[model samples]
Target: MKRIMLTLILLVGIGGYTTYAQSELSLQECLKYALTNNQQLARIRMEEDMGRFKTSEVRAKALPQVNASGQYTNNIKKQVLAVPGELIQEPGKTVLLEAGTTHNVTASGTLTQTIYDQSVFTGLKAAKAGEEYYSMQSVQSEETVIYNVTQLYYSTLVSREKMIVLDANIEKISKLVNTTGSQVESGLARKIDLDRMRVNLTNYKTQRTQAQNQYLVQLNQLKQQMGMSMAASIDLPHTSFKEIESKAVGALDFGGVNLDNRIEYRLLKKQEELQEFQKKAYKAEYYPSLALSGNYSYNGISNKFDMFKGSGSTASWYSMAAVSLTLKIPIFDGFARRSRVSQASVTLKELNKQKEETALALNTQFENAKLQVQNNLTTIQAQKENVDLANEVYNSTQNNYNLGLANLTDLLDAETSLTEAQNNYNEALLQYKLAELDIIKSNGNLKSLLN
Candidate 1:
């Protein structure tokens, strides 16, 4: 029986340790896992690959293409015609003349090249620009992912911290209940004191339970974002004033939204440039297309059915080469070219307006994030003071209650005030973090934070 009891105690201790360990995950591990294993990142990378392939496909038009062909013909009868009367110098007798049909088999190999094509050149350039756009978009997508990961990381961190706080509170209340129970058993303290301690202990247990639930939920959320298994658990480290102090919030040194370096800005600029190119591309159709084409062929003509004829009967082979210039001028297309150029011009103007709007929006968001961080820094200090003051008041109230100078109701009020202050301080810290993250993202610099 003693051995079984000992085994039961060991099992309980192991279970408790496991539950304790599941409460936290480190920030670095979370970020690393998130960036390296995320499905969204993979999808964006695939898009980048697709863009690259499209550019390659466009460029391939400049390369040479080779082809081989063969033809066979058989004529069952020869063609016959009447002799011309002018050749005979008389209209009297007409004679039938037969031009024998020839049986022939021919094979040829040819190569065609696009030496210069205005539309192909324009398309290749546009494809290159498109590749650049998608590449930058991938970078921006990565930055967005990193920002989300940071927010979730901090949220999980705060939840775990709250859980720790609640557990400590529960432990303190349990100790109080034990003390009150002893006093009541000895008939010194009233049974009402014991009941009150028990009630407070229950409330602490409820709060602790809620905190644990939040912690687990946040952990699961982080795991999901990191592309880990749903059953995977994470353990995060504790954060303290020392940790916060160790990190520095640097100065905001934005060069005022460089239109060229910013990805979204550059993408818009490229779109406008591409539209301008498209206007010219469409105009290429209005200009006549000129191509110089040449073909060299060898043909063998035979009146006999046999392809390999002896020298007595003749098999003649002819070689020919010709170069010709072909020109196609479009005189009418029902205003298609005119309408396309107009549409392109309109689109370019719209992109120009969109760029201006984006620049303004970005500047506004940047300034707002900076001001928010600065303002919240001040509020954080005040919230810290509030928490300190509430803690002191609660401690004093407890002391006064032990001395019979303060009532249970007063202690309860002090506890409530302290709890609210703590929650407010926690929320302030989270808000400050979110504000800082906003600045990090607006600057397009999330890689340093996550990777």
Candidate 2:
């Protein structure tokens, strides 16, 4: 009995875990998941962190730098020096003497501080712009992810809706086929009518199968965009058509919108700022640099290699300290600085042109999104009315055929009209949703999708 209980518990546990892994996601949940799990967004976040470290690295150049160094040498051949012998009362003669020490060691610690360096200071300032550029890039990446995920989410929803419509048509036609079969048996309908009903039923079943396949494909795409496993089964709850229609009732006004509000435009502006900093960094190369440096050093020398021993004829040691100021003035660099500055200036000009072009382009996109939203909303309303009319016609024809007042041909035509109307309505609805997302993105409010 215990073994059976354990087996049941294990099976239950596995089932629960599988269900959790395949849990259904709402649009907001999908967006949130993508932000946290999408590989590209994670990379962008890492890049932002790297940018911060880079800024710190550049800033450190302006701070005091301290370093320690040590050196030891075994002079296998001593260096000889030649001097006139007159100082030792040997006139008109030259003497050669070897320098002392078979072993030597020196250790030093040095500190350097920059007092004035235009180039370093410019680089430090540029670091801030570089950080800002990376931050803007992260924001842009997030917006792009949100846009793409939302698009896939809505597309999957539409495909599911299409499947529902197809299923309904199949069910309705199956009933009609049965009714026609009965009428032919009763000799009230011609055998040809029964044939027509069967053919219509077959077509509806084929369409339904195609729609089901399409829905599965779209669901897989949505899963990929959300960074979920493609094999995971996700169930999306049915969304009411009325709910979608309600969201599109109002016209969007973009007259007060500015290009700067858009993330893409802001990213371009950040790029322009970074380019200006680059130009400044290049021009700073012509300025002189000044620094302060100090060093403390110890030197030891001996005939033997025991420079650190205190027992047997210890080595002599001496300490020295010095502080100095260094000034480097750029006199000429074979026109290298001139060429770099010119190149930087040209790049700055190019960025300015790109900024202008981007602004114009953003404005155009905003206007077009606004127009598309309005047009698609109108289209949705018209298609909704058409679908309603088609549905009513199908119902009336079905009733008439049951009463032997209408032929199977009339019923099949009504079914086709209804199917076409539903498909058109769903397509228009999808377009309106996409247009709404565009407007939101153009207004720099794509983040609102999370809400």
* Worst lDDT 10-window in candidate 1: 1-10
Root-mean-square deviation of every model: 8.0, 5.8
Residues 1-451 of candidate 1: C-alpha lDDT, one tens digit per residue = 0000001111332321212222333455556656676778879989999999999998988676566667766756878888966676767777777774577666665655666678778888888888987888788776666777788877876786777777767776677678778878998678987788788878878888898888888877766676565544456656664333223243444434444545678778877877877887897777666555566666666777666666664667666666666676689989989999999888988998999999998778878988887776667677778889999999999899888888877877787787778777677677778887777667766666743
The true-versus-predicted C-alpha distance at residue 368 of model 1, in Å, is 1.8
Model 2 Cα lDDT, one tens digit per residue, 318-372: 9999999999999998999899889988887888898788888877887898888
Local distance difference test values of all predictions, in order: 0.71, 0.80
Q: How far is 169's C-alpha from truth in model 1 (Å)?
A: 1.2
Q: Evaluate model 2: give its TM-score.
A: 0.90
Assess the local accuracy of residue 306 in candidate 2 as a C-alpha lDDT between 0 and 100.
82
- Score candidate 2 by lDDT: 0.80
Candidate 2, residue 40: Cα displacement in angstroms equals 0.5
- The superposed Cα distance between candidate 1 and the true structure at residue 113, in angstroms, equals 2.8
